[model samples]
Target chain A: MTAITVDRLHKTYLVPEREGGLRAAVGALVRRRRREVHAVTDVGFTIEPGEVVGFLGPNGAGKTTTLKMLSGLLHPTSGTATVLGHVPWERDRRYLGQMALIMGQRNQLQWDIPVLDSYKLNQAVFRIPDADFKARVEELSELLALEELLRKPVRNLSLGERMKCEIAGSLLHAPQVLFLDEPTIGLDVAMQRRIRSFVAEYNRRTGACVMLTSHYMADVEALCRRVIVIHHGRLLFDGALEELVHRFAGDKTINVELADEHPLDPAALGPLVDGHAVERSATGFSVRVPKAETPRVAARLLAGLPVSDLVIEEPPIESVIEQVFEATSAEVDGG
Target chain B: MTGERLDADWTSGPRQAPGEGGLAGLVRHDLRILRTYLSLGVLNLVQYRSDFVLSVVNAVITLATQVLGLSVVFGQTTDLAGWGPYDLLVLIGVHFLIGGVLGLVVRPSMEAMMEGIRLGTFDFTLVKPADSQLLASVQVVRPQALVDVLVGLGVVVFGMTRVQASLSVVDVVLSLLTLLCGLVVVYSFILALSTMAFWFVRLDNVLAIFQSLFGEAGRWPVTIFPGWLRIVLTFAVPVAFAVTVPSEALTGRLTYTSALSAAGLALLFFAASRWFWFFALRRYTGASA
Candidate 1:
């Protein structure tokens, strides 16, 4: 069964509007104005149980709005979504009990208490049986290496430590579906990798479906095989991670090394890949050409120039995602 | 990756997940969760033993100030507006009791929830499977306020000794029930105001006005106030219900209609505030960025 299925889900917000100054404020008191903000416009996607999918977008691209809706925290203006055979926005107790949403920026754990004490509060609220609570605590503590941190007050723990405890505390219920919104937003690279692996490990151990949003490319590269990319509240691409690169990262960089120990003239290299960006170097230049022009441009460069070595490479995933957003945002701006 | 499956049991009780049956079951589940939050607050307080001493000192000083305020008023006449000094002591006791109750869970939790909404952490509350109102109202508990609770009881019993009237079992029971209703009325008022933080976002000063009004106005006997104003307090704001109606029940002066009125207004206050909380919460979910 599908863990999550969202069809033509849409959200629009109406926010109060007013100009600055005393006169406008007085005017607003007489007649308030509102402007409609279309947060998510007819977005749709689905994920099967046990799959980890990356949710990608620029700021205000409705990534969070979609996640909020799927987790039952939001009611969309239109359309429908079900997570594990229950309509999410209905907020059935059984549904909430079976799913978890962990936003890295927010702390659900009680601040002044020991981490384990905070976990006990969750135990009481979620009403986990005693034996299960103990066993799951033991299992998660071991898996997360939280034994040392569990006894310390949450305020005393380091940021990374707090996040570890936070994740472990949230998973005490062992939910079937996990929505992680920017779960590794501000961690250092090593801690980010640690959390990424921990999430992957937890997902593997429980076979839970994980939908994650992260600004860090490494996080998506490590954990997400399939990705959904949205820009300006519209679905831009949804495919394999590599396919996203291949589809939107349309440029290929060809780095050339000169056979002769002499500087090459820029004017002489004008015939090949004329519209592309040909950045110069001491040995030889590197030119970024559209993927379609790579082979012909390479052949032309090989025949026309004094080249010792040439390497053709697709751009990094970070640049690829950036290109996807920039190109899509431009389209949005135009229309 | 470790492929070992977690022996997770979702169908099993955390304590027995809420929907077993009926209203009583739901209340029991919610009360247990409240106990968890309260005990956690106590455990957190243990980390700062000095705070307990400070609260004690503060409570005693506050009690002295109230006694002095009462003395100055009583010094002017043998009995002011037909209330013996000791009868008004019961009123004083109810004031501190309601104050203590408000400080303990109602005010702190409201402030915490307000800050949570402003900071976006209230999202954590909405995500919980429990009732949002229950979670928000008890999210932060101050153990220090229990000192006032104890002191308030001490004053009530002490005042009972000096009074010239006998309290029957029904009087005692009615007094306790009215007192509970009083607390509910005050809690509902504070919560309704706190919920306004959803729309206003910066309502830290909102409770100050209510606190001062409740503090200053609750100490006086409701009968001492003018007729129209007393009716308004008894039904509308319910500050009279907090400090007057209960003491009136305790001192053998409570009429059944007043007791019934207190009960009715308590229910009204609770229903109104509960409705207001969800109304604000809906806005919060829809409008939070």
Candidate 2:
């Protein structure tokens, strides 16, 4: 069975609004004004049991609202969603037992107690048997290198260390469906890689479904094969990560390394490098050309310049994703 | 980092689905959860050992002020209203005892919950696979408040000796039961007040106003208040039910109908507060959201 199925999910919030200053505030007292915030629109997707999917969106783009709904922490304004054969918003005890939602800034562990002690509380709440609890703790600590941090209170741990401990504590229950919202936020690059690898390993071993959202594209690149992107509370695209890059990235960058120095004017390179900005160094310059014109551009550069090593590459994924957002907003403004 | 297949570990006994566990089993489950929370609460208190010692000093000052005030009132007259000085002492002891119980767990947990709501840390609480009300009502405990409990007990014992009141086993049992009933109502009332944080996110002063009301009016018996004020104490905030009814039971002044009403109100308030809690939860626009 599919681990998650969401159809036409929507969430709207009515927030009070008033103009700044005393006159408007006094007027609002008599006639309150409220604006409807459509946090999540008619979004629909289904994830397989063992799939690792990336949820991509800019800030306030409804990524968090959708995750909160699927994790059963929210009631949708209108829609249907079932995770592991149960309606999420019903919040059945058994449903909650099989799933976990870990938000990076929000910690479930008790701050004043040691990390292991907080896990013990989870052991009680989740009704984990002794043997399994012990084994899971041992495995998780070894995986997270948390043996040293387990005995110290959470407040004493650094941001990265506390995040490690927090993730370990959330996993002690061995939830089948894991929702990680920006789990690698505010960590150094090395720590981010460690968390990303751990999450991949955990998902592989248990055959659990993992849905993750992050502002760091490295996290999405390292862990997720498929990505679903949303903007303005609406779905923009859902496909393989490579397909996303191929669909939005119409231009390929061609880099050339010259064996000998060549004094060449960028204007003399002709129309192939005309519109694009060519980044120039002492040896060679790199220019972006349309995917169809890469071969023509590469041949012309080779015949025209001193003999050099040439390479053609796709644009970086960050620029590709940024282009996707920019194109959508341009459509919105023009429409 | 290990490539070892964890397939065997996934289907193990750690994830026990909700089964046909009987009511007794459910009670045991809840009791275990409560014990875990209590232990964690104690561990937290242990970290702040100086706070515990300071609570003792605060307790001593509070008791001294109460005694000095009682002395001034008793010095001028043998009784206020229809109650003697010793009877009033019993009422004062009951007030301290009830307040101590609330300060121990109820007040601390409510404050923590409110702060969590304000900061959006309450999302963790909503995601737990347990009764949200029970979890929210007891997440933080302060054993430092036990000083008030001990002082209250000491005053009750001393007052009984001075009055030389003859008490039977049934009288003691009945008073204890009434005291339990009174506490239930008080807990529910405070919970309802705290639940307002869902709609009014910045209600830090609400509790302060409530404390002042209970502190000033609860010192004298509800009977001494004006008619409107007495009704308010008995029903609105219910400080009278929490302190006066238990004191009445101990002093042989309780009527059977009054005793019955206390039990009824306790159940009604508990149900209403529970309903209100879930209703407010649905309205909770999370700070993060």
Candidate 3:
């Protein structure tokens, strides 16, 4: 069954226009000008039940806007979306009770209260029974390793700890759908990994659908197999993660470590296939080669040099997504 | 990599959410949420004792200045605009009472609502199943204002005792009804003004303007102002409804027409403010465009 289906969703914002200087400001006071900004234009996608999907975009690409629309926090300028068989913008209590939205940049906890108290407030808001609330809190605390952290005030916890508590608080009701917008932003790598694993496990346990948006590719790599890429408020790509890499990033990286500390000569590697550049480091050199030529280049490097450690990897997801953004923008510019 | 799957199943509750119930049930749920908010506010106050002390000191200084102003005005004249010393005392007490309620709940909540709209955190409020206005109104609880309210009650009692006339039950009940009407009017006015933040984005001075005007005009009867200013105080901003009308009810000087008008205006303001709030919310959510 489909968990979410957003059809031709569009959200356009009319931002007031103003220029600097007192004269212009006074003029604006008399009669303000406005310009329309198409924050999300014709964006559409379907997310199946229990499927974890990553939303990838740079800032202002409308990822958050789309998430807000899906979570019923926003009303789209046009089109419609349904989550778990209910129109989201109607904000049906049953729908809201079955879903949760966690924004990493913003916190839902009271800053001065203990994290557990905040969880209790969510319990009341979501109307979880006392026993169920306690059981769920215990379950989430165990999963997120949040035993001692719940008693401390939210302000007293570190960013990572606070985020973990936030995740726990949002899930106290055991929502069936989760819209996590940059849920791992500003967290350290370990904390990010911990959250990703928790989300994956939560999905496994409950069979809930998850749609996550993040700047951290590691989050996507660890948690999601499918990704939707958006740029300039338009959908650019929607497919499997491997397909994204294969389509936009055609090259694979080869890292070679010499058998001994010796001077490396670029000329010796000479005219690497397809004129790909070799980047030399203190201990090793990495060269990018087309996916088809990866085996040939590996064979040549082993046959020619004293190669001790060799590793071949797809270009990092960060660089690959960046290339996709640039490629899409270049296409827009060309058209 | 997919994490190891856990076989734990969701222990689902076969029940609808609290807000999905009937009207009476929804009211009960909202009241429960309000109790939680108030208790959380008390917890927050425990952490900021200095703020509590400051608020106490502020309330003291405010009452002292108002009392001293009464003394000064009484020294100059036995009565101003047909209002005697004791009558004006009741007015000042009513002013503080209304101010205390606003400070305790309405003002802080409105400020938080403005900040939330500015910072985009208000979305959390919208996504909740409960009524958005109910959530926003009780979102922040300022316990410090309890001092002002208690002091205002003390002032009202002291003023009424100092006067020669004993208050009949009808008088007290009438005063309370007017007070409720006044509070509804004031709250609706503040709400309508704050809702403008969704469009203006810079209303920092808006509430300050209300406070200043109310402070200046609410101490006296709107009748004292010549013509235009009295109309503005009574109709435009409703400062007269908040303070003077309740005082009139207590002083037994309220006309039946004025009392009826207060009730009618309270209803009008409440309905209008609620309508404007939803309109602004629709605009903010881009529902119109």
Candidate 4:
């Protein structure tokens, strides 16, 4: 079943245009001007039950705006969206009870209260049965390793620990759909991996559809199979991560380690490959070439230079996604 | 689903949640908060024992000045505007009691709500499946104000005894009902004022206006004011309901028509306040695109 269906959603905000200085500020009080900011324009997507999808976008690309609309925290100016067959913006209690939105920068937990107390409050808010609430809390505690931290006040926990508790508290109701906006932001790699694994495991166990937005590609790489790329409030691409890479970035990076520190100019070897240039280093050089030309370039370089070690890798997903946005912008300019 | 089975699963009660729990649940939740606030209030008094002592002394001095003012007014005659010294003392007591309750939740919560809106924490209140007004009103309880409530009650009892008016069951019930009605009126008035925050996001001054008006008008009887000013205080701002009408009931000066009018106004204001809250919420979510 389609747990979430959004069709041509649009959200526009009337942002006041202000000038600098005290004089302008005083003038604005009398006669203010507002410019329309189309935060999300013609955005649309759907998520099936139990599917974990990653929403990728740049800053100010309306990712959070879209998530807010889906979670019922925001009302779109036009178009329609239904989560679990209920219009989100209507904010029906039954519909709210079946979904949750967790933002990394925003905390729902009471700062001075213990994590357990916050969970208990969630129990009341979500109307979770005591047995079910207890079971879910225990399971989340085990998964997030929150045994010792449950007694501590939320203010005392580290960022990662607080995030773990935040995620756990949000899940106390066992929501059928989860909206996560940069859930693993500002965490160390190890902490990010832990949270990513926990989210994956949670989805696996509960069969809840998860829609996550993050600038961190590693998070999407680890947890999401289907990726939706949005830029400037427009959907750029929606497909598997691998397909995104192949469709946007058809190049491979070759890093060659010479036998010795060769005093050879990188530009000297530029024409040897198909316009491939050595990126920078003393003992090693990195070259970027199209996927089909990688082998030819490597063969020519190996036969010509005193090569010792070489490694070929696909470009990082971040770069691929960046190229996708850049290509979209170019297309708009061309049109 | 059966009520018994639902009740068994929800350890708290058959109520959906703290806020969602119908009227009974709301009352229970509010009472629990009151208990916690009472404890915190005691703790705060102990922490600032010196301040409390000083404030109590200051209050006594203030009360002496009020009595002196009353005596000065009565020096010319036995009564001013048909209310004697003892009757006026009861008015002061009722004023303090009502002021104490408003201080406990209304004022602090208004300020807190403004701050919450500014900081985006109000979203937490909105997302919960509870009455947003109830959640916003009772989210924070100030315990220190209980001192005023106790002091007011003591003064009322002493003043009533001194007046030598026999307290009947009907009089007592009427006083309680009027007091409750006064509280509801004040709550509705404050809710309407705070709902303005949804539009005038930067107008923290609106609450300051309420505080200043309440502090000034709440101390004196509406009857003492001039005709136009009396109408403004009675009907426009409704400060009369907050103290005067209730105290009038206690002093046997309340009319059945006026009491019924106060009750009717209380109901009207409560419904308007609820409607305004939902309206503001709709605007908030809609405009926050």
Top-TM-score structure, candidate number: 2
Q: Model 3 clash pairs? A: none
- Scored against the true structure, residue B53 in model 3 reaches a CA lDDT of 95
**lDDT tens readout by residue for model 2, A84-118:** 99898777777887788888877777777788888
Off by over 4 Å in 1: A257-267, A272-275, A280-284, A302-309, B1-15, B18-24, B286-289
Candidate 2's residue-wise lDDT over B30-59, tens digit each?
787899988777666677788889988998
What is the Å distance of residue A291 in model 3 from its true position?
2.5
**What TM-score would you report for chain A in candidate 4?**
0.92
Q: What TM-score, computed on C-alpha atoms, does each candidate reach?
A: 0.94, 0.96, 0.91, 0.87
* Candidate 2 error regions (>4 Å): A272-275, B1-8, B13-25
Whichever of 1 and 4 has more DockQ, that candidate is 1
Q: By DockQ thresholds, what CAPRI class is model 1?
A: medium
Better model by lDDT: candidate 2 vs candidate 4:
2
Residue A196 C-alpha lDDT in model 4:
86
Q: What is the TM-score of chain A in candidate 3?
A: 0.91
For model 3, the stretches where C-alpha displacement exceeds 4 angstroms are A19-27, A145-147, A255-268, A271-275, A280-285, A295-311, B1-14, B285-289
Per-residue lDDT of candidate 3, residues A133-206 (tens digit): 77777777777889999888889999999899988888877788999999988998888888888898888778
The model with the greater TM-score, 1 or 3, is: 1
Candidate 1 reaches a DockQ of 0.50
Which 10 residues in a row give candidate 2 chain B its minimum summed lDDT?
A: B11-20
**Chain B alone, TM-score, model 1:** 0.92
Instruction: Flag the better candidate by TM-score, 2 or 3.
Output: 2
Accuracy of chain B in candidate 2 (TM-score): 0.92
